[model samples]
Target: MSSDDDPPESDPSPHVTAVVLAAGRGERLRSELPKPLYSVCGRAMASYVLHALANAGVSRAVVVVPPDGRGRLIEQRLREDAPDLNLCFAVQQEPRGTADAVLAAKGQVHTTQVLVVNGDLPLLSAEQIRPVLCHDHNDAVIATAQVDDPAEMGRIVRDSQGRLVATVEYRDADPAERAIREVNLGLYVFRSDFLWNALEQIVAQTRTGEAYATDAIPCAVRNQSAIAVEVELPDGRLNVETPADAANAEAVIRHRIIDRLLDSGAHIRDRNAVWIDAQASVDEGAVIEPGSHIRGNATIAQGSSIGPNAIIEASTVGRNCNLESCTVRGSVLHDNVEVGPYSTIRPGCTIDSHAHIGTHAELKEAHIGEHVQIGHFSYIGDAEIGARTNIGAGAITCNFDGQSKQRTIIGEDAFIGSDTMLIAPVRIGNRARTGAGAVVNKNVPDGGNAVGHPARLTPSRRAHSTTGDEL
Candidate 1:
């Protein structure tokens, strides 16, 4: 009843629990935030690994964190990002090593198999992780990749006829072992019993006094324990530790997201100039112009055209909408809305359908009704405009008078004149009219007319009939 590409109905390996190594203090990044909490494509870097584990059908996880302030922050962010996965935390008391980090999580992992992974890898995916989960017959399975340059990676050493020899770190390997091309990818799956026994036997390396996970492989070989080495291509194994690595990870993630958008019928003219976050959703038939950034769960509905230099964050843009050279944050624009160049829509603003916002207009905390027209160079804040209202050029809503912010309410079918200033706590009734340069400080009744500075209410003006008489 379903295609082969569809995800399975249940978890493939529910007996496998993941142990994520994240307690390391990354000093090379020179950031106050923890390395695992660093942002990659507008998401925490470690979230990718957790998502990969979920994709591989491993839902239960125990994240190992340092026993400090960094651990609390990492735990909180991971909980927010990957809430679907059943997760718990384990504290690594000291900066011992990867092996020690895994051992710290031993108490939390109750599954038959344990999946160990590094949290700094932002480019990891489900396809790369699923293969290691398949080889469950062996006591331990280590994922290996062949790279063009194995500069400082741990090498997978083998004896004559290519039998398993040992996993040697670059700092501790001989010349022959260093020349081997196959390197450890730092993704491993081990049986729970074998892992606990092997990790306990590993001694700290003399050079760094740290017990590396790579040392467990040699112990398995020496003890004649069944071990499997799964070979995969070098694609999504970038471990981000520095600024350069972070940039590379972001570029790879952006490319993948752009490719997905293109495949889903979205039009991106200049891919090189746009930066979209991983959480953004661009529907089919949407056109994204150059220099645009759609970030933080923003949604662009179908038939919408987003600009040649627009920054939309945490907003929703409806169908057939056009936004050009604007910055919209935390706002909602309904269908058939048109926002002109250099307009800024700040938080808590909602523009209804058929509304036309002219160039250089700024709105904040304002609720605009249907068919509303706001002309150029206007600033409307803390205001609510009714349907079919026409706000003229350079109109201002002086809602803040130094002490507190007040509200401006304009009724339906109102015509606000050019350069008009409506002072705080003012109300303009339905069908009311204001002359150019009027500064109104009081309320106007329905169908009334206000003119001149410190505007006073006057008699309603009637429309002229075809016979030259007032209607």
Candidate 2:
């Protein structure tokens, strides 16, 4: 990636356009979601392929989808997920062959060279694609890999003098041919002119009625118009076609994420136990304990300590914050915040700096100010507490009033005794105090005290008027 100060590269370094084949319906997985939309580490499977293309300096891509509701859904989701890439969609009207899928994207790509890859390969990386994109005079550069058990994969055919020849699908290959260790990885970079001509002439298989992209190789070899090269990838294509395949890909992605964090100075207690998603960010000097699952786009800043059993999903944890065995979902914790074990912070909660939330506390849609203390066994939902407030143990914000939820406002420096209940739509003024087991339904004025069931306020230093009064 070029830095902001660096000048962009000029032309002559071929601009390669990409065509992602994602129209297939993976029946083996037994799920209603499209194969390309399958989630691998909380992201769509095809997103990795597009990201790889973007990393390889390909700015534009055409994704081929089936012509149905699934295709429309895939287009919508991918567009929303990948806003960085310039993505265009093409509809494959029929479930023809892979070659036909590329044909569907014919006019969409306007570049001399084109890259074709399967969208189900969640492990696709920029390193594997760079060489193919850089290969200059080849009519077609096909990526191949040597695998232990090349089950149902196409085997790359070579001539007597070890020259590149045809590629045979597994079903069509004989026993001796099937024994070849090297299999087609289904990734190819092709010259646009040669690709268009070859794809036009390729024939469909008799059994499947689908035209294979591999047929283009023989066309190139037979015509002898352009040079075809094979680039063997070190790691084979890790495509997810089944549930087991998805799990394996997820494990690899998880390991990569953790390893990256470890290399970048983050401390991970257990590599195997901690599962951090690809989009999650754990900065240097952060510590992730065992059994922690950081999901979605959560960010843990420097000096933060997360888990021993915590789950943080789509949340942000600021510097020096400590989260124990709890679940923080769609919330934000500012600097120096401390959440005790077993606390559940739901969506729309924002905890300010230096605040401490006690164990077994649940907060939802609450805005907690700086240095606030929420005691154990408290439920602060639909409430806003000002700075330096102390919420007593077993305190409840009775927000739900049978029909609708209401708000509770607690002012700064206020102290509520243990087992106090503040009913909804109530306000406790600054420096106010509530006695133990008080059930407060009306607003308490500043510096006033409430001490009984259906609590009535005692005389205070300040007074409140019936009408709107400026004190």
Candidate 3:
């Protein structure tokens, strides 16, 4: 039962439902966004937990979202990104207690066993979750850790028979309990029926009218139900609820990603060249030069060369593409495409097969067709360039006019001369040619030649258009 698959019922298997508690208003974090939505290693922190759960074969999940606008955003993102994973959202109307949040999702979970997890733990992996689930207990099994200091944490209390008796909070615990080294890490596996019953009893009997999941442990123990403790791997637990903690989490996640990549045979030229949430495939002969950061699920194919200093993110580079000293984000480059010595290929830019972006060129939200050449010191934004076009040095598409951005289209075999400035919302047709130092602000017909500022066609040039040399 992987997180992406349906749970099964058998020995060494259990129909498990995950209840992720994400409703807390992290005052300590001091950010307007919900804590779970905060980024770690270029992805939302909660995504790590979701990935772990999915990998562990726990398919069904109930994310307890806060009763706020952020919760809706979380649901929307989850629907878009992880729709295949059985996801249901329950609202925590207020910051009451962790126990109450789980109770809110009672009706949605059908499995006999439930795994409660913290949404803010970014370092936890699926392997750590299996132990708690496999522990045979009729009542509950909690993941506890042996920390050097148990201050302000719930201390796990055990009986003479080594059964979990109760968890004593730091504020309420006696001196002996406070001295205990083992502390609850707020992860648990519980029988669904027992959990539901315990929640109901706590809500009814407690004077504060707020139920806590921790309070249910004593209730089960008082009834003489079997309760067990499972200690977690020392390095598996991480709490990232504050800015400091978030930084720490980032460092840990970065190191782990680097280790995973190195173990998988990827070379890291420089530790400072960050590869965040990137999936890269380098052929044995490919070289990733220094000062290049590849991030956001990008992939580099075989024989490709990237960076002396470049950045590629959320993009795909085809085989044998040469990307040196350039910055490419949210873009795609096809095979044999060459870019940079100093270039910016911004989001939504696509350079087709065999296209060349020469030195000091910048492109934003543009589409370059195959075999196109964009010369040095050119700015091509909000534009479309057809196949086999040649754009000269200093040619620019003036996309912005202080109010709105407009489009420019250059057709196949079009030649844009040096020092040419193409004002927005213009089109240059196939086989069209613009003379040197031309400022074109209007549409030019196919096979036509235009010259001068706010260019107009030269009549003599039109008659002998075919006689001119290819650009």
| Candidate 2 Cα deviation (angstroms), residue 266 | 0.6
Q: Identify the runs in model 2 with alpha carbons over 4 angstroms from their true place.
A: 1-14, 201-209, 225-236, 459-471
Tens digit of lDDT per residue, candidate 1, span 345-435?
Answer: 9999999999999999999999999999999999999999999999999999999989999999999999999999999788887888888
Cα error, residue 174 of model 2, in Å, equals 1.6
Q: Which lDDT tens digits does candidate 2 get at residues 48-133?
A: 78876776667789999999899999999888667355799999999988889999999898889888999998888766676777
- Local distance difference test values of all predictions, in order: 0.83, 0.83, 0.78
- Using all chains and alpha carbons, the TM-scores for the candidates as numbered come to 0.89, 0.91, 0.88
lDDT of 3 by residue, 319-380 (tens): 89999999888998999999979888999998999999999999999999999999999999
lDDT of 1: 0.83
True-structure lDDT of candidate 2: 0.83
Give the clashing pairs for model 2: none
> What's the CA error at residue 357 for candidate 2, in Å?
0.6
Cα RMSD, model 2: 3.6
